[model samples]
Target: MPAFDAAAEFDRQVRTLNALGYPALSGRTEEQFAELVAPLRAEAVAHAGTPDEADAPYDPAATGRVPFVLVVTRALAPIERTMPLTALHGGKLPGFVDRTFEPGSLERFVATEEAEPPGRDGVHLLFDVERGEEFCGVVPNDAMAAVAERGRSLLTIEEGVALMTHAPRILVKNKCFSLGGSRSGDRRVPAIWISRKAPKLGWCWAGNPHTWLGMASAGARRV
Candidate 1:
């Protein structure tokens, strides 16, 4: 992993999304999907370099530390449709939301102003990610404050899902993290973790702290 040629890197992400079958889930073919996100290539072109190294919470893999993640906003591929398509353990199985989340429960979690992506709909580009595992054991509410204090934005639901979608290696056991960027005006904080050795979409109490769950954040984004 070395410095990336931004255009090539962006193309790689588009290929990844196509390979993940995202287009089909959204009722589009690979070609249509690519066409939809073609604008992001121009956006990605402006950001050229990406770090290749990663510490704990983010595994050491070919992807290393993700420089940026491309998101097909919920407007294009809804979480309810995409979550089940997320694969783990080399695609041996798929991801699933915890049963506790009733239908439409996910819709309640909206991105906080600090964590909102630059794009209002369609695709987005999140840059300078700091997975925020250091906040593990800190209550979600407190972690949110810490992230803001550090001048970083918490990862929104779509951003967190996109991270795992392209970099499954990041979802390590006992090192999973929460999406404090999305809240339902209550205690529930969305999270992605390993359940039964596979990726899982779940939630945690905002006031409670889990030694294994850190709150994730990012530095910038683009439409």
Candidate 2:
């Protein structure tokens, strides 16, 4: 697993959200996002071991090493929804849970590749909300980034949701890249979702925003 660039990924997602005309957040400046990511980055760096890239985690599967895992947290609604079932235990919700909601529901319909070794070789996991299944796939990080960059200009709401849901590997890459920077490897990145309802709250491992949008639209006064 490579150390993930959470701030960069967040920037990319914000840009994508803005391009999609779904922009809602503004108070957390880039600096703030960077500040939030700093500790995680530091943890990655500290554990990285070898100095000057010599001790970096080696990918037996890949010829090189890459830092992985970019965790990002965002406010989705003003009032957060609770999932007592999953939270009651110390176990965290898997990243795939986002597929159960509206937009992500579409992901269950798509076909994707299988997971592979980490480093350069990208692997993605999809949680099918409709079917109650989880799918894994192999993808190129750069390829995923390209799709996201293109999605900024080419994707429709339906397409975006579909991509976000069914093709989460690509969506994560897109979201990660859209948030900024890039990653190389088969690593697990966690996204925390915050509800858009009043008195915003956070949920661990929630990545899709379809449900959040509904709340946002309903709550808006439309100035």
TM-scores, all candidates, are 0.87, 0.24
- Could you give candidate 1's per-residue lDDT for residues 77-137 as a string of tens digits? 7888778777664757788889988888888888887776675656788876655677789
Tell me the alpha-carbon RMSD of every candidate: 3.3, 18.6
The best candidate by lDDT is 1
Tens digit of lDDT per residue, candidate 2, span 100-175? Answer: 2344332222212211112221111111111001111212233334333433211111222322322233322111
The C-alpha local distance difference test score for the whole of candidate 2 amounts to 0.25
lDDT assessment of candidate 1: 0.77
What residue pairs are clashing in model 1? none
How much is 183 displaced in model 2, in angstroms? 24
Model 2 regions more than 4 Å off: 1-27, 49-65, 74-223
The local lDDT score (0 to 100) that residue 121 gets in candidate 1 is: 56
Error of 2 at 10 (Å): 13
